[model samples]
Target: MEGERAGMKIGINTWAWVAPLTDEELARLAPRIKAWGFDAVELPIQAPGDWDPTVAAELLAGLDLAPAVCAGLLPEHDLLADDEQVVRLTEDFVRHCLRAASQVGADVVAGPLYAPAGRTWLLDADARRATTARLVDRLRPLAAEAAERGVTIALEPLNRFETSLLNTVEQALEVVDGIDGLGLALDTFHLNIEERDLPAAIRTAGDRLAHVQVCGNDRGVPGGDHLDWRAMLAALADIDYAGQLSIESFTAPALAVPMSVWRPLATGPDALAVEGLAFLRGLSAVPSAKNSRS
Candidate 1:
């Protein structure tokens, strides 16, 4: 408490509500999200007008809640595609999302920002380096675009099955090397699958950790599964990561197929989100090696 960031805003992704999000859905969910003690809400940006930033911003402002952007880069929007058209389209989509993020008062446009989710392939050492080089080239001009919009593009590392590239913090850091206005979005679910030492990885990310998405290791409620939340919270405090800890689980129909959600992650999305909030709010009350000193 003495050393942690004074206020750590908690958020729930509208993925918990719906995917291919609509303006109507966001309008309806924002108030309820605000009522649930969330200081912020993360909206999924699928296209230029999928959800109007100006409208969402106004609604959140009325609710006294902050907004954050999560760029929905489906398989169709692959930045690392071999097809030139796909690559160009993906770049445009990212630029569009960056503008939307700016309009919605969010400084970070966050997502994998690479190939489609759940697509994996093998790559040799040379091919891996070449692919990384290609991503850096593609992202360079977009980084400039992001900077213009006062946005930082946070590259998230999905699990190995979801992606073959940038599945670890080290890999993501290398990809964003020499690129300004770019950072890493660490999802604890992915880290649970990929990192040997999750807290060490978080510490290693340190300042480059632009955004954090939290969930249970089993993709359930945060405290309902096996994750070292205490250590993770302390690592966040150590880095002074002044960003919202957004819960990023998916709903049953819209994202369940793609995200591999076979059954209910909770009684419902609201219960899952509410329970996680209670656990995090109680973090400071429980002393551990990570937070006892604080």
Candidate 2:
């Protein structure tokens, strides 16, 4: 944080250590996260009761660590599905997360909200268009809800394997085009897979980019794998996006197979967090165009 671009903050997700983070886990991990020099802690809301927002708010405020909120959508939370009940359920969950974020003093709730992860299917051009219309309609009201609570819905686009719709910045932009309270949350892992040029995609997102998630191309430690970290940071600088670069690698045992995380990225979660923080901090000391401008 010493030499970071003005207004830019770095964060790490609780998912990097645990899934469905509880208030107890947050209390335990937050001190270490602050000690490691993270500006914020990205908290996950896998369900409404996964954590207590009031407790989290107090703990974070006490440690001087900012709070961010991310969400996990199950198959039942698909907004584009044919079932009205399913759409209603999804809306309820998202609203709960937005309220939780507001309670925890987080300005944004970031995640793939249109459809559940791992829900993919074939779609003809005509069907795809129809689905897009449905998505926009469904999300408009939620965007309004987020705005009312002073929270932005940072919609994320997953890879082809995770979801069929909204796989690129262009697609996501289209959905959020006329929506005021909706913005994009780009993850480097998904960008590496779906984007032909990562930096260009970041530039395209521009001011609408609300949140950012970083990890190695292989879903490991940020700087321990093959990714152009400097270029990515530079593109962020070009956009003047003063958002948090939250690390979002997953390590929960139950998530290994579903997430396809077959190999260990570090000796343990602590090592991964510490190493990634060190590498990113080192970037701040290196002279670059962004640093020169600063």
Among these predictions, the greatest lDDT belongs to 2
What's the alpha carbon RMSD for model 1?
Answer: 2.1
Alpha-carbon shift of residue 112 in model 2 (angstroms): 0.5
Q: What lDDT would each prediction earn against the true structure?
A: 0.83, 0.87
* Steric overlap count per candidate: 0, 0
Shift of residue 215 alpha carbon in model 1, Å = 0.4
Candidate RMSDs in Å, in order, are 2.1, 2.1
TM-scores of all candidate predictions against the true structure: 0.94, 0.95
lDDT of 1 by residue, 167-240 (tens): 99999999776678899999999999999999899988978888889999988888888797877877777677
Point out where model 2 deviates above 4 Å.
1-3, 284-294
How would you encode candidate 2's per-residue C-alpha lDDT over 42-143 as one tens digit per residue? 999888898999999999999999888998798678888788998899999999999999999999999998787888988889988888888999999999
